[model samples]
Target: MAMTAGVLALVLCVLCFAGFWLGRQEAVRIRSGGVQPHSLPSYYGSYVALVCGIPASLALLIWISAADSLVRQFVIAGLPDHLSALPEGDLALLLTDVRNMAYGRVPLNTARPEIVGAVEHYLRLGEISRWLMWLVVLALAIGGLLLGRRMVSAEFRARNAVEQILNILLIASSTVAVLTTIAIVLSLIFEALRFFAKVPVTEFLFGLTWSPQTALRAEQVGASGAFGAVPLITGTMLISVIAMLVAVPTGLMAAVYMSEFMPGRLRAVVKPVLEILAGIPTVVYGFFAALTVAPLVRDAGMAIGLNVASQSALAAGVVMGIMIIPFVSSLSDDVLNAVPNSLREGSYGLGATQAETIKLVLLPAALPGIVASVILAFSRALGETMIVVMAAGLAANITINPLDAVTTVTVHIAALLVGDQEFDSAKTLSAFALGLLLFVVTLTLNVIAQRVVKKYREQYE
Candidate 1:
């Protein structure tokens, strides 16, 4: 049925194009006879094409979406009264399986006559829907062509109409992207709400313990899986701090060097090398953190007589910080470079040393962009999963010491969903709640970054 509907829709579209060509030919003939229209022949063609295509295409889409459900309803009504007694949800599932079986994709396990009858009805209804859809599309296309042909005349302003339609279509296309973002956020919000209902928001927010594993069977014994998210939050914070410690100075210095100090020939060589850091996959970074960096950190800590887990927050955080350095340096470098050369020249004319000019003038002027870069880096650090999962231990220690093992929220979420988990369990729902919290925190940071950028622009302008 879907294939039939698609083919019919394609036929209508081709016919619309033919109508457009015919309209253009007629318009050219009129112009040759010295009764030129207000718009060019091609504009008339587009206008006719739009008229024939848009309405028919819309009708085909609506029919395709509605046809299956409508057919299923009729089929269900024809089913035996005993079959109708089943709950609507179960009935829908059974019908779906039966239809799948009828299509030869799968077979129903049950041998009930009602099920067999329903499948047969479903197939017949599908055939009817296909035929009806083709007829509707043909009618819409023909009507649109006839109407468009009547409007083609010397006084017609086809170009203006076509442009107006295009403008509306462009806005509609852009709106779909914005609406999709909104829909995704709303879905996250609702799922998170369901999670929060199972666990107290305060406990999820501020509890110190971080264990999320719960007993699978009634016979199992342990602390009813600690949902205290504090450890995860602390781990995230600690890793972010470590990342910033590594990234900020290195990234800022690199930006400063690139913008104010490096000669062009050297800059060309160095900039691409630095940007190559940004292209490295996070999974590759994870392996480096897990295999190379974590062991090294463990050995270094042992040498210093400090207790460090093999997978420690410090190792992951440091690697993550290294991963994000390019993000900070590149954005900061561009913003710094955007500052006018006049500012540097004036500072130099005033006898300020190059270092002094960069430190006092350019740095302060580019502060907002620099701060935005830091916030963006921070968000990335907080949201990082692979490095932390590979290098940081799963144990959720509430302590802030970087040498100790810790679990982050992202790692916890990943662990919870990695296996088949019952949907209603606190362990599973906690992932959604954590995701919501993550989203909120990142969104807040982004909003603040935008505001800071705006303030900076206002100050400079």
Candidate 2:
């Protein structure tokens, strides 16, 4: 079908070009006869090309989209009522078998007449559909070509028609993007609601314990479990805060020096070296944290008479921050560099030193972009999992102490869905609840960032 479609597309392209040539020559001959056209000869040719291609492509898309489901229904009609009434999973497997047989991917048993007949019908219908598409599409392309040529005249508004079609295409693309976002949010909401139904929303939101184990029977020991999300939330915030503390000032100051003070050659060398941090795999960062940094942190803590777990939040967070530095520095450096040199020059004209000028002028001008970059870096730190899993042990401890082992929302979610899980289980469903909570937090941060950006933008621009 794909090959056939490609062939049809090639044929249509050739015919559209033919129509363009004919229409263009016609317009030229008319213009030579002293009749002025509303548009150029090329515009008339383009209009004919659009006529030949657009409607034909649209019909092809519509037919391909509907063909599979319609053909499946036709095949299912010939199957036994027992097969039709089978459980969804069983019916799905049967459908797969039938499709495999139809495609000669499976050896069909001569003993089953109904299955054989259904496979034959499915293949036959597919063939008929392909032929039907080829005939109808080619016919439409020829008809559209003639109509476009007949409509071509001195007064035709070919450009206007093309523009309207372009506007519709733009609107359709935007609608799809918005619809996709809505679909994601709706799915999360539905699943989270299912989770909340089984576990009380209040308990899940405010409970301090983080166990999610449920036993198979009431006679089992430790059958019931706690689902408090406070520890996960607190641990996420703790690691993210530590990461920001490491990333923000360092990344920002690096950006400032590179964009403002460094020589061009040094700046070129250092910037790439720093960005190399971002390119190194997170798993590498994880292993580094686990084997190298975690031990170092433990030794440093003991030497200073402070107790620190080998897999502590500090170890994970410091490594995670190092991973995120490039995100901040690259974006901030670009933002600061993008600030018009005119602004800096104006400050110098007022007898401002380079340092003072940057503090009072360039920073303010680039504030919006800096804030956006920091927010992006913060989001990355919040979502980081591998380093946390490797360096910070999966203990949901609600402590702010960086020396303590802790787990984050992402780690918790990953833990909950680690193996084959029943979707209806509160244990599995809790992942959705945690996801919803994380999403809301992220959404809130985005809102705050947008407000900050808007306020500073009005002042700067």
Candidate 3:
């Protein structure tokens, strides 16, 4: 069916192209006879092509989406009475096995006769559906092409029609984007509400213990869960603070140098090389943190007569900071460069030194963007999981000290959902609660950043 659909799409594309060519040629032939077209030849072509393709494409999509369900119904209706009378859940499972066997994903040798007959019926119905889909879609395409060609006169207003269609398409795309975001937020809210029902909001928000192990059976030992989330929140802040401390100053200085002082040739070379850090995979950074930075941090702490865990927040934070440097530097560099040279000249006109002018004038002017970049970097730090998982152990310790093993909300969220488990269980549903918390925190940060930016922007502008 997939192959048939692909072929149908290719055929529709070729027909649309033919419509475009014929429409364009007709407009040119009219112009050769000295009649001015209502729009450009290209507009005429686009109108015909869109008319030819749109109906066919929509029909094809609807057909393919409905085919499987229609085929399933037909096959089930033809099933023997005993099989058809099974409970909905059991019937669904039986259909799944039938599909697997039909697709050769499972052995058919042990299959019962009714199951074999159902599989054959399913395949036959699917094949008929594919043929009907092709005929209906192609007929629509041909009809649309003829109708469009007949409408393409010198007064057809093809450009206005094309632009109207494009506007509708753009609005639809934007609507889909907005709808998708709403759907995601709604899903998170619903699932998190389920979790909150199982665990109280106050305990989740303020509880210090972080263990989420629930007993599978009544006799299991030490499986009573603690859903307190304070420790996870504390660990997240510890790592993110450390990361920002490392990233902000280093990245800001690099941005300042690149935008203001560095030679153009050297800046060109250094910028791409620095940005390359952002391209390296996070898992690779995790491996580097575990094998290289963690041991180094442990050794350094020991040499200073201090205790540090083998997997500590400090190692993860520092590595995460290094990873986000490019994000900060790239944005800050663009912002700094956007600061008008006239501002620099005005400061220099008053005999301000280069360092002093940058400190007072350029920095103030670019403050909003700089703040935005730092906030972005902080968000990046907060969301980091692999580095934390590999270098910072999932201990969920509520210590301010970076040398302690810790875990972020993201790490715990991932840990909670890693293996097979009951979806209704608090252990699994807790991941959604953590996700909601993270979303709220991120949204709050964005609001704060916007307020700060708005204040500074009004002053600068």
Candidate 4:
């Protein structure tokens, strides 16, 4: 189906271009006959292209989205009554097996006769669905082309029509983005609520212990699991604070030097090289933290008579700060550079030195943006998982000390959802609760940052 959709997209592109050429030539031919074209030749071409592509693309999208559920329904309907009447979980697994067999993921020879028959039926339905989709889509495209050609008279307002369609498309794209965000929030809320139903909200929020293990059988030992989130919250804050301590001064100073002191030619060369840190994958940073920084931190701690765990929050936080340096420096650089030169001139004209002007004038003016960049970097640190997982062990220790092994909310979120398990269980549902907590914390941070930015902005402006 994906291949067919790709081919159909290529075909539509060719057809739309053909429609464009035909419409443009028609408009030109009409103008040559002394009837002035309604809009530009390009507008006429665009009108034809939009007409040829939009309807067919919408149809193809609808068909592809609905195909899977329709296939499953048909396959299930063809199954024997006993097989079809299984519980929802069993039925879902049966359908998965049917799909696996149809796709050759499972060997058919070892399967039951009914399963084999269902696989055959699944293939047949899928083939029919694909062929029908192709036919309907192409027919709509060709029909739209003919209609668009007929409508391309001198009186037709091609530009207005085209612009209206484009406006609608833009609105639709925005709506999709907004809806996706809402959907994510709603899903997290619903699942978190389920987790809360099983584990008391107060206990999960304030309890000091962080175990999430639940026994499989009634007779199993250590069945009751503690779901206190304070430890995870503390670990997250500890690492993030350490990261900010490293990132803020370093990144802000780099920004200050580059934007103010460095020559323009040197700035141009250095800024991109500095921002390249942002492009390096987080896993590589994780590796550096685990193999290089962790050991160095341990040795340095030992050298000073401090007992540092091999996998400690200090290593993760430091590497995470390094990773976030570009986010801070690049934004801060732009913000500092954006401060009007008039302010600097005024400060200098008043007998202030360069350093004094930077301290009293430039930094004050760019405080809002600088704050924003630091907040962005802090958010990046809070959400960092790989470096924490590799450099800081998953102990969920409720400690403020950077030398201790700890885990953040994101690391545990990854841990909780790693293996195949029952989604309804408290162990799995706890991930959603953690996600909700993280979301609230981030949203709170943004709100605080906004208020700070607004207050400073008002005073400065």
- Provide the TM-score for each candidate, comma-separated: 0.73, 0.77, 0.88, 0.93
Q: What ranges in model 1 sit over 4 Å off? A: 1-159, 170-198, 212-225, 260-281, 299-306, 417-425, 458-461
* Model 2: residues with Cα > 4 Å off, grouped in runs: 1-36, 40-66, 97-152, 213-224, 262-319, 384-395, 401-405, 411-421, 458-461
How many residue pairs collide in each prediction?
0, 0, 0, 0
lDDT of each: 0.86, 0.88, 0.91, 0.91
Model 3 lDDT tens row, 1-461 = 88999999999999999999988888888888899999999899898999999999999999989888888888889999999999886798898998888889989888888888888888788778988999999999999999888878888899999999889889988998999989989999999999899899999999999889752432344444899999999999999999898899999999999999999999999999999999999999999999999999999999999999999999999999999999899999999998888899999999999999999999988999999989988888888899999999889788999999999999988888876556777778899999999999988888888988888883434
Ranking 2 against 3 by TM-score, winner: 3
Q: By the TM-score metric, which is better: model 1 or model 4?
A: 4
Cα RMSD, model 4: 2.5
The residue-level lDDT of candidate 2 at 422 comes to: 60
Model 1 RMSD in angstroms: 5.2
Model with the higher TM-score, candidate 3 or 4: 4
Model 1: how far is 186 from its true place, Å?
A: 4.4
lDDT tens digits by residue: candidate 4, 162-272:
999999999999999999999999999999999999899999999999999852333344455899999999999999999998889999999999999999999999999
Superposition error at 415 for model 3 (Å): 2.5
Question: For residues 334-364, could you state the per-residue lDDT of candidate 2 as single tens digits?
Answer: 9898888888999999999999999999898
lDDT of 2 at 316: 91
* TM-score of model 4 (CA atoms): 0.93
lDDT of 1 by residue, 350-461 (tens): 9999999999999988999999999999999999998888899688887788888887889888888876456666777788888888988999999999999888762432
Give the number of the best model, judged by lDDT: 4
lDDT score, residue 137, model 4?
Answer: 92
